[model samples]
Structures are given as C-alpha cells and as structure tokens.
Target: MISLPEDQPRRISEGERDAGVRRLQEAYAEGHLSHEEMDGLLQQALTAATHGQLARALASLPAEDAGTTSAIGAVSGRILRRGVWRVPRVLKVESALGRVQLDLSRAVFEHPVVDIELHLGTGRAKITVPRDAVVDIEGLRAGWKDTLYRPRRGAGSGGPTIRISGAMGMGRLKVRHARR
Candidate 1:
C-alpha cells in the first residue's frame, strides 16, 4: 500500500489512470520495458484507487521518449497535438497547404532544451508554449510572417528552452504563451 503524507487519500480519476497506461504502453513500444513489466504496471494502473498509488505506479518510467519524433501535416490536412502529451527532445514539424498546432502547455518535457524544426509551405503553423518557457525563433526566411510574442522577463533560467528554426514559404508562423 502506498503511504500518503496527510492520511487523506486523493481519488484517481479515469483520465489519470488512462494517461498512466498510455505512458506504459509507449515505454513498452519503445523497448524501454519488457512485456511482463508492462503487464504488471498496467494492472497496477488499472487498479490504482488513489493519486499516490497511481504516481507510484508511474514513478519508474521516464518523463518523455528517449529520442526525437517528427509530426507531419500533409496537403489540405491538419495536425494538432495538445493536452498531456510528451514533448520530444527534437521535434520536426512539416506542413504543406495545411495547418499545424502544437500546444505545450500541459506537455511533459524531459529535456532541458527542445529544438523544433519547421518546414511550412503555404500553410499556417502555431506553437503555443508555457509562459515560463524560453522561446527563441531564428532562421526564418523571407515570405513568412512572424507573429511570435514574448514576455518582458524572458524565459526563466531553470525553465525549458525552445529553439525554433527553419523556413516557411508564403506561410504564417506564430508562437505565443498558453492562456492557462
């Protein structure tokens, strides 16, 4: 039994349990855990009654994936990533005649610095980051409109640093703070 500090147990919601299960699945797919280990963890996650128990079940897993990932938006399509998704160390986003939105407000970042390489072609791309994160936009070529807004204080030293680069042809790229 997991011990709680205040003796008052906090109920674990279904969403939280599902998220834990997804993380375990990802770990298993990435070869980070064996099939037996994943089965055990999934059982614990499904039966976890309290927040503390759920946290204990997921405590041994890594915060994010071990390597980089790429998300592509093809022509006339949309690609969106939000909610409690994991942010990779290096993310490559490409959109051609489509829209792409990456919201990192509720994301989990394992790396201190996240590099995003964008390749937009006649499409719109928006990246919404946390207020505390440091955003650096560079190497934006011509024919692209930049609507990135930053705070006066800049990113905190301890916060994650997001470095955005690459080219956008006749496209719009915007980066702003998350509302929440």
Candidate 2:
C-alpha cells in the first residue's frame, strides 16, 4: 500500500453547494430518493463546509449525462412541436403573441431530468407530457390565468422529471398527461 501525506480539508464554495442541492433535487424528481431523503440531503448539502461533505451529500447519484440545451423563440405566429422529436435537457421557449404547443408523449427524453423555461407574452401554451412523467411547475409565474394542471395521484410510473419555470404574460398554461 502506498502511504499518502495528510492534507488539509478543502472548503467548498457556495456554488458547489448549490450544485449539490440541484443534484439532490434532480435525484428526488427522478424517484431515486424519497422526499424525506432528499430533504435530509438538501440540508446536509446546504450546511456542508468542506468538499468531502458536499460529495457525501451528492453520493450515489446517477452519473451526469452530457445533455444539450436549445432555445425556441417565436413572434406573432403558432409554434408547435409534435411528432417524434428529441427533447433537450434544458429548453428555453419565448413567444410573443403566439400560441405554443409541445406534445412530448412520443418524444425522446435523453435525460432523466428536463427543465423548460417559458417566457410568453399574450399567448396560450399547452404541454402534453407522458403519462409516467413527473412535472413540477411551482416555479412558473403566470400574469393572467391560473395554470390548468391536474396532479397525478399516487406515485409516478418512473419516467423523466420535467421542471417548468419562467414567466407568462397574459397567457394561460395547460398541462395534461397523455392518454393511451
């Protein structure tokens, strides 16, 4: 066995801790950890003082995927995305006075967690997710109508997690799970 010299513990920065927290959230969304477990890990990550502590908080998580982000913007027209499309890990959608529809029931999800940030203005947006998908729209802010979404009862059937955020101006968002 090789003998190693004792070294000082490296302190982690706030950004590192924040990244750990994000990883925990993704793990929780993917059903890899229960809510309580995620909460505990989140607390640990938030209070982590060293790199080892932060690493422990993020331990046992799935390997990070090399996913891509794409942005879609439209002005005064209809933006529709259906058929067999590849869903990016992060999607930024911006529309001005245009209707937007994204049907992901038949789309390919390359990542375990996906984030969709929408910045809409005076347009209606409809999103169709897979039946087994887990969606969290708590970060979305609507200036007009309340979002139309029915939460799925019980646990999910194990699919990707979609996190939607950003602002909607004078628009209504309707999210529905796809039906067979």
Model 2: residues with Cα > 4 Å off, grouped in runs: 1-57, 60-63
* C-alpha lDDT values of all predictions: 0.76, 0.86
User: Residues 1-180, candidate 2, lDDT per residue (tens digit)?
Assistant: 655555658786444555567778888889999888888889899999999998888887887775899999998899899999999999999999999999999999877678999999998999999887878898999998999999666425556778899999999999989884
Q: TM-score for candidate 2, please give it.
A: 0.67
Candidate achieving the largest lDDT:
2
User: Which portions of model 1 miss their true places by more than 4 Å?
Assistant: 1-66, 152-154
TM-scores, all models, native as reference? 0.58, 0.67
lDDT of 1 at 144: 56
Cα displacement (Å) at residue 98, model 1: 0.3
Per-residue lDDT of candidate 1, residues 1-180 (tens digit): 977777788785454565577778878898888889898888999899998899888888887554676565576688899999888888888777888889998999876668888888887888888867777676555375765566535444345677788888887888887765
* Count of backbone clashes, every candidate in sequence: 0, 0
Using TM-score, give the best candidate's number: 2
